[model samples]
Every structure is written in C-alpha cells, then in structure tokens.
Target: MATAAKKESKPNAGFMKPVTPSKILAEVVGTEPMPRTEVTKKVWDYIKKHDLQDAANRRMINADAKLEAVFDGKKQVSMFEMTKLISNHLKA
Candidate 1:
C-alpha cells in the first residue's frame, strides 16, 4: 500500500477580514466589527433563535422588525438571497 500526502488549507483573507455592520444589521448581529463569516453565523443564530424560518419552506427566512430593516423592508427572503442582502450591509 502507498501512503498519500495530506493537503493543508488556510482561511481566505477576504472572508477573515473584519467588516462593520450597518445600523440596521447591527440590531441582529451586534455593533462590534466582525469577519464576514462571523456576521453570517451571527445572523443565522438570530434567525434560528427567533424561529424566523418559514414552516412550509425552510429555505425562506421570515423577517422580523429588525431583520426587515436590514432586508430593505422585505418581509421574507430565501436563504440564498439572504446572503446577498446581508453583504449590502457590510462595510470594509
């Protein structure tokens, strides 16, 4: 049997760099600057904690008052669209 070399990987610098969240986004994710990855995690945490996902369609996230502001008044958004919307609120 032959042994194979293992590959090592590092996190992407762009994703690791800290970003400031917009005032609307701050309500859910906090006011502190955080990496994009952490912002996403915190947003998801808020969603899950608030039971914001649609019952029929788990892919859809129902926006609460705070999230609605971040979502630009959208009452609901798909999980895929959620990321795009969130990116708009992040400042480098």
Candidate 2:
C-alpha cells in the first residue's frame, strides 16, 4: 500500500499584511510600513530600551511623553490593552 504525502501549511496573510503607522505610533516604530507582528516587535523593543515597563508589575506599561500621544494621553496601560490601543494608530 502507498503512503499519503504530507501537506504543508500556508502562512497567515492577515498577520503579514503591511500597515502604515500614524505619526504618533511612528515615533516608536519608525515611519516605514510593516506587518503588525513587526510593529508589535518594534514597540516592545522601544519599551524595553526605554525601561518603560512598571517595576512592580511587569504587565503595566509606563507611558512617557512620546508614548503619551500614542496612548491617547494615558500615563499607564496594561500589556494586553497596549495592543488594542496600538491598533488604533495603524492604518491599512
């Protein structure tokens, strides 16, 4: 009897779709258009570089002057909420 061939999985296009960041978001992720995953990575990099994560609670993010604009004037936001807020600053 012949064995069945294995099927390869395709990458998710939605995650790879290019999105343009607003001016506020550009401050953290740069001005180039990139996939959402890359944007999230860049944001995390900036957060880490600036030591913006709350010392007491890692899940909380401390927004600086630059991030304040992106965060709609909020000084602090949760790690989970950060992604939701960031989405508002992105456009197709």
Candidate 3:
C-alpha cells in the first residue's frame, strides 16, 4: 500500500478583518456619500466623462469644481497622490 501526502492549503482572504466604511466627505460636486472604492470609481467616471485626463500626462488628474474641494483646492493631482488626498476627507 502507498501512503498519500497532504498538500498545503493557502490561507483564506476573509480571515483578515474587513475595512469599516468611513463617514462620507462632502464636496460641492455631488450629494452621494460614496465609499472610497465607489468614490474612486465615480472620479474615474467623471474624468472620462469630462475628458479631463491629459493624453500627454496620464498621471495627472485635473479637477472640476467637486474634485477641487475634495483635492483641497488643487487643480490637479497625480494618480497615486489622489488616493492619499481622498483619505484625508474620510472621518476616523
């Protein structure tokens, strides 16, 4: 008789604690209280809709009125920088 060997299993993703949704931030731009994920989605939506993304400078996100408020009066922010700036508006 041959003995069988056990295979190691990968850890489950759900074991990690879920992130709590922070309180929504307000901007002159919209009334929706979107979570960070949703907010990011919406920002992309707006960017595409407005054709704000520069073809030459893909990293820069140009702000409309709503985005300006969320971005702390910045007319533009880098893609990576936007995430950090948005986090500031979320309540602890």
The clash count for each model shown is 0, 0, 0
Task: Give the C-alpha lDDT of model 1.
Answer: 0.95
Q: What digit string (tens of lDDT, one per residue) describes model 1 on residues 1-92?
A: 33456556899999999999998899899999999999999999999999999999999999999999988899999999999999999999
Best-fitting candidate, scored by TM-score: 1
* Count of backbone collisions in candidate 1: 0
What lDDT does model 3 reach? 0.65
What's the C-alpha lDDT at position 28 in model 2? 92
Top lDDT prediction, candidate number? 1
Q: If scored against the real structure, what TM-score would every candidate get?
A: 0.93, 0.89, 0.60
Pairs that collide in candidate 3 are none
lDDT value, residue 82 of candidate 1:
94
RMSD of 2: 2.8
Candidate 1 to truth, TM: 0.93
Off by over 4 Å in 3: 1-34
In candidate 2, the residue pairs with backbone N, CA or C atoms under 3 Å apart (3 or more residues apart, or in different chains) clash, namely none
Better of 1 and 2 by lDDT: 1
TM-score, candidate number 3: 0.60
lDDT score, candidate 2: 0.94
Candidate ordering by TM-score (highest first): 1, 2, 3
